[model samples]
Target: MGIEIIHRPLRTKNALWLPDRNLIVVKERMRSVHTRCSIAHELGHVHYGHVDDRPKHEVQADRFAAENLIDFAEIRDHLGWIGHPQLLAAELGVTHRLLRTYINVHRLAS
Candidate 1:
């Protein structure tokens, strides 16, 4: 909960969590939604004690971000009128990746 967040120029990454420093560094050029989602994803790594970039850890982080960022009620409202993933993501104020991760995780859980 004491993790620090800073915006810095990252050449090739959206965001990353520094375990040693309890800090989350986000790329300065990301859009608002992406910046927020990236921070949430990095916080997931902090919450889950992730120190490496394993696929499972990545998914876990993504799921954490999606669940927190996209409300299920909002997704449901969009689902009735929206059929495209991109549209749904846009309407929900999330990236397409987050929308897909939400679906995939819920699919697995159900």
Candidate 2:
């Protein structure tokens, strides 16, 4: 799949996936972690064959990003000593919100 990645200034959305053109557009000013997550999420959309812009598709994409980006075993092994969410996020190289979402969606006991 010849997927092209383009970075530009997006107004409302962090990223968008054009399935027809196999294109992923990301916001240029986003932080590195955010850009990575957004691209992963868009790739998730592509992998899962999500063409409709629905909430379920977004959730699935989120799940895909979380599962692929963070290692569950690593988090489980390190989470006990990690007191702050920010610290855990930093350790996992993900945003605090993405970490929280992964915890919630996976129902991992914290």
Candidate 3:
């Protein structure tokens, strides 16, 4: 699908996807990494054909974004050992919260 990305002010969420319209609306003021992850997550929703707004779907989308955006093997190779979550997230160009979620979802020790 040719999804069009639109950057604008969103009241509640950082980004949302309209599957019917093939559009993704993102908050313009969001940080670049957040924006990228948000878009990736939304794209996951689209790719997975998720129409229900359920917690499981959201988790799946988040996992998809984390898996695709942050390569675990690459990060591990580069960092060797991750002592701090913030440092690892910063090195991976992702939010600490997202990194934690990724770790939890993948059952990886941080």
Candidate 4:
């Protein structure tokens, strides 16, 4: 992909893709798992050739990141023990939003 990744202080955004430079910029001060997910999300945007950050494009990227970060088998294994979403997301080392996206995809697959 030849995409370069860099960390910066983005006050409002976790990560974003620069199509012109083929670069992915991630927030510098986030947690480790969050940083990884953000990078993955930006990579998703690059993979889909999204030139702009629109809602539809965001959803696509989120789905891509979630699918890549979360394993369905692990989700299933954790479902019985993890009753709260926050805990589940924590256990999975992902954000709640990513966990939700993973759940939506999981439902469709099932």
Candidate 5:
């Protein structure tokens, strides 16, 4: 995928990396935010040297993705003002699961 993001309709449901092109292709039906997340996650794999045969590489990539997309200080400020998890998730274009996970993982809620 020469472009920033590739949409492959005939491919699998999840995003895949074309190592030959050094690109990440995701499903055609995926949301723009999800596509962005896929790109960031794949970039994390490259940035963190996750190419090695490690058992928990996927987990690390996921963590990196969340960290890259989310800002703990911003979340804390929004939570302090809004007091609604769903609204914060909606603003961030992330799932409620990830919003809650970020709060818990970063101790944002105290």
Candidate 6:
């Protein structure tokens, strides 16, 4: 009732909160990994009761998403044995690009 994942050509992957209906729409076409990330972001907004009036909310959502989705412990275990980014990305259920970004953002790789 709170959030619904929809597939559409959204200018940006975002959610629309309908106060009247108490519904949230999340883009479904978002990258495999980003789907979870976006879900977490929207949940953060709802959990914190963010007004979504400022662009900063997106950044905050992203931070919440990274914290929720990227399993640092699992990532470390996999990366320790697998040096290939693509392989690790596949195992982590994310794209290579997203994996690289996650790695860089978390400083998981040197």
4 or 6, greater by lDDT:
4
TM-score of each: 0.91, 0.89, 0.88, 0.92, 0.70, 0.60
Candidate 5 vs candidate 6, TM-score winner: 5
lDDT of 3 by residue, 1-110 (tens): 78899999999988888877889999989899899889988988988998765899988888888888888786667555466778788888887767877888767773
Give a tens-digit lDDT track for model 6, residues 9-74: 557645564444545666656665766655666776766677664677765655665566668888
lDDT per residue, candidate 5, 1-110, as tens digits? 24355778735445755555666667787777777777666666676665542547765666677788888677756776346877887788765655665676677675
Q: Which ten residues in a row have the lowest lDDT in candidate 6?
A: 13-22
Q: How far out, in Å, is residue 39 in model 6?
A: 1.6
lDDT of 2 by residue, 23-44 (tens): 9999998989999899988988
Q: Which runs of model 5 end up more than 4 angstroms from their true locations?
A: 1-4, 10-12, 52-55, 80-84
Q: Candidate 6: list runs displaced more than 4 Å.
A: 1-14, 28-31, 80-89, 94-110
Which one wins by lDDT: 1 or 6? 1
Candidate 4, residue 28: how far the Cα is off, in Å:
1.1
Q: Which segments of candidate 3 are over 4 A away from where they belong?
A: 78-81
Worst 10 residues of 5 by lDDT: 10-19
What local lDDT does model 1 show for residue 14?
Answer: 97
Error of 1 at 3 (Å): 0.9
Give each prediction's root-mean-square deviation over alpha carbons: 2.2, 1.6, 1.7, 2.1, 3.5, 3.8
- Model 3 scores a TM of 0.88
lDDT of 4: 0.88
Q: Report the lDDT tens digits of candidate 4 across residue range 4-91.
A: 9999999889998999998998999899989989998998999899999999999999999998999888888887645588888888
User: Which residue pairs in candidate 3 collide?
Assistant: none
